[model samples]
Target: MKKFQPQPGFVVQAYKFALDPNAGQGAALRSHCGAARTAYNWAVGWVTASWWQRRAEETYGIGADELTQWRPWSLPALRKAFNEAKHTDPRFAGWWAENSKEAYSTGLANAAAAFDNYAKSKNGRRKGRRMGMPRFKSKRKARLACRFTTGVIRIEAAARHVTLPRLGIIRIHEPARGLLDRVQAQAARILSATVRHERGRWFVSFQTEVKREIRRVTRPDTAVGIDLGVKTLAVMADSTGEIREVPNPRHLDSALKLLRLASRTVSRRQGPDRRTGQKASKRWEKANAHRNRVHHRVANLRADALHKLTTAVAAEYGTVVIEDLNVAGMLRNRCLARQIADAGFGEIRRQLTYKTRQNGCRIVTADRWFPSSKTCSGCGAVKAKLPLHVRTYECDACGLVLDRDDNAARNLAALAAAAATGTGVAGDQGTLKRVSKPRGADQKTRATRPRRKAGTGRAGGAILPHQRQTETRDRTQAEALTLW
Candidate 1:
C-alpha cells in the first residue's frame, strides 16, 4: 500500500499480483516449504527429546541461546552442528541438510516467536492463556510460501518477477499493469514478491513501497451502514435510504454431491488405522486428496465472493457501520453454525474494517447488544424479541412492516450516530431489544406464550431440542436426502 505523505490526502492504494511459477520454480518453492516443515518437526523433536532427558516440563528451562546450540532449528547454526554430528545424529543426514536455508530459518523463527509469545502472555502482555513450547505443524497441513514483513513485498522492475532466496523466478499470472508500469517509470520500487501455492493453485502477492496518489471523492458526504446476516448476507443502508443486498453464497449445496461421491470413494478404499500404526494405501491417499480438492473448491468460491463484495463496498461507502458479531458464541449454537458459516458474516465485517480505512472511509461498530434486528428502523422503537423465522419486523407503535434484514440494516445506520456520540456497554446484544411484539393480539399472545428471547429454549431439556429434531429429521429424510 502506498501512502501519500507529501500531499497529505486521505487515499491509499495497493495491488496483489498473481504469480505463475514454472514447474521447476514450483518444485523449488515446495522444497523450501518442505524443508521449513522438516526443520520445524526436527526442532520440535529435538527440544522435546532434550526436555524429556532433562525431565523439565517447564519451557522456562530451555532458553533461546540454549536452543540455538541444539541445531536443525536454523541454517548457519544447523550446518555447523551438522558437520560435527554428521554420523552422530540418526534423525536425518546429507539429503535433508541439502534443503533450503529458509526451511531452517522458518523453524527457528517459529519456535522463537512462539516462545516469546508464550512469555509475553504469561506476563499479561497479550491475550489468551499461558502458552507452552511451540508444537511442530504436521506434514498433512498445506505448505505456505508467503512470508509477512513490515513493508509491502514487491517484485523488481528489471526482473518483472523476482526470484526468492531459494525459490526461482516464476511468471506472474497477471499482467502487472498499473504497479509495474508505475515502477518502471521511476514512480515506485518493487520491494519483494513471494509465490504461494494454496487451494491447488499458485499466486504471487507483491508488496511495493511507492508514492501514494491523492484522490478526491466525487460524493464526499456519502455514508452507509452495513448490517451482516446469515440469511441476507449484507444489507447496506446508505444516508440516501438506498438499501443493497449481497446474498450469501451457499456453495455447500453446489459441491455437496461431488463431496459425497469423494467421501464414498474414500470409504470404499481401505484406509489406514493410525491406532495400529498403519500407513494409508495409495488409493486411500488419492481419494482423500480428491475430498480435499472439493473442500478447497468450496473455500475458493467463498473467498472469491467475499473479495468482490468487500472491494465494491469499500469503493462505494465513505463511512461504513457494522456490528461486532459474536461469531464464537454463534458457532456454539449447533442449529445455526452451518448457515452462519455459509454467510461468512465475520469475514464480511473483517474485510470492511481494513478496506474502509484503506479507502479513506470511516468504520463504526455497533455494540453487540444495540438491537439492530429488533429495533423499528422507522420510528427508533426498540423491541424485546424477534424470532429468526420472523423475517418481517411488524412494529406496533409505528406499524412498520419491513424486510427483517432491511430493517436491521436501517437500524444499524441510525445506531452509528448514537454509538458515535455515546459510550455503550460491550456485552451480549440481547439486552438492547427490551421487547418484540408480533402482529398477534396482546390477549391472544399472552394466553399461549410468555416473553422470551428469539433463540430462547422454552423447554430446557436435558438434551437440546435441536438434537431431538435432528434425529427425527435424519431418520425421516435418510432415504430421500443425501448428506455430503
Candidate 2:
C-alpha cells in the first residue's frame, strides 16, 4: 500500500516575548526595519517611473520578466538600485547603511509582488477578473519585519544563542524549547526569520516548514454554527444545543478618552512641515508615541479575546459552519462600524476558518447571500421583510415569535446541520426578520397590527423579554413608533 502522504499544512503564528534589548540592539533592529521599508518604496517608485515612460507594444504586453530586465525587481537588482540612488539621487543621500537592509528589501519585495500580481492578472490566470499593482506602504504604518534566510539566521545549541547576518549574535527571550530536537529529527526546517518591534518590545519569528505526524480525528461527528455580531463577538450554536457567547472587547471604546487627549496634545504641538524640511518637535513625537502605545495595547487585547474564542470553538466542534460575512460592506454602516471593529467580527470568522483545520474540524462556509436569520428554524417559513429595529422574530403564518438574532442563530445551526447531512437548500428562501430597532424593552406588537394565527416563527433572537417594536398607524395621530 502507498504510504499516506498528508496534505501540506502551514502555521503562520506570532508570539509575544519579553525582549529587553540594549539601546544599541533596539537601534539596530529599528534601522533594519527602516531599510526594508526604504527598499520597498524605492523599488515601487523606480518600477512605476520606468513603466510610466514606456509603451505596451507586444501581444503579451509588458510582464514582470521583461520589465525586470528593463527594470530592477529582484533583490540584487533592487539593492544595486538603492546603492546607486543612495549616493547619486541626493534625495536618499546618506540614508543607506545607517538603516537596516531589511527596510530596503521590504520596498523591493512589495513592488515585485505587485508587478507579479499584475502579470498574473494580465495572463487571465488570477481570480476575480484581474488584479492591481500592490500599493506602496506608508511610513506611518510601517512595522518592523526582517526576513533572514538560513545562513542569515542560526541557532547555537549549547548557548541557546541566535546569530543573525551582519547583526551578529543575540540571545532569545526563551530557549528554543526542543526546536533543535525537531530539526535533528528532520521534522522541521527553518525557511525564514523575522524580527519585529511592537508595544515597546522586540520579538523574533521563525517561518518554518515542518512535517508533522498525522492528526487523528477526535470528534468527527460534532458540528457547529457560529454567528458573529457587534453586541456579542459570537453566538455559536452547535449540534449539542450549546450556544457560546464571546463578548466584544470594545478596546478602543475604553481608550477613547486617552486617545482624544493624546490627539489634542499632538494637535497643539509644533508638527512637522514636510515642504519646509522640518521634523516633528520632540514633544510632538513623544505624544505620537504615547498614542501609538495605547493603540497597540488595544490591538493586543482584542487579538487575545478573539484567539481565545476561536480556539475554543475550533477545539470543541468537529464541523464548523459560519456565514460568509461581508465585513467590509458592513463597515459602511457608520452606526455599527465602530462597534463591529471593536468586536472584531471579521477576525473571529477568520480565526475560526483556519483553526478548525488544526483541530480536526471541517469549516462549512454558509453562502454570503444565504438568509440564516429570516427563515424559521422549526419550519422553513422565511419572512418577506425583517427590519433592523425588531429584536424578535415573529412568523405570521407559523405564529412563532422569538429573539431576532437568536432565531437567526438557530436557522444557521439548522442550515449547517442540513448541509452536513448532504441534503440542503441553497439561496434565499424568502427569509426575512422583523425590522428591529435598538431601543427600550417591552416592545409588544401594536394592537392595530393584525396578529396572524400561531406556528410560523421558531428559534429565538437577542430579545431580552421586554423588547420594543415600531408603532405605525394610519390615523391623523401619525405613525408614532413608540417602544413598549
Return the TM-score for each candidate structure.
0.71, 0.73
Least lDDT summed over 10 consecutive residues: which range in candidate 1? 475-484
Weakest lDDT window of 10 consecutive positions for candidate 2: 475-484
Tens-digit lDDT track for model 1 on 1-484?
Answer: 5542333332234466666777787776677666666655665565446445433433557643344221123334444553454446665565655555545566555654554454344434557556655677876674666443323344556445655554545566656667767666556655544456777777766555566543344454666778777767788888789998877778876788998899999999878896898888999999999898999989989989998998887877666677878887899889888888877878888887777666677677776767888889888788888898988889989898899989988877765455445443322421223234535555455668766653322222122222223332222222111110
Give each prediction's root-mean-square deviation over alpha carbons: 15.4, 17.8
lDDT, candidate 2, 99-119, per-residue tens = 545556666766666665565
User: lDDT scores for all predictions?
Assistant: 0.63, 0.65
Candidate 1 runs further than 4 Å off: 1-23, 42-92, 128-132, 146-161, 214-218, 272-289, 419-484
Model number with the top lDDT: 2
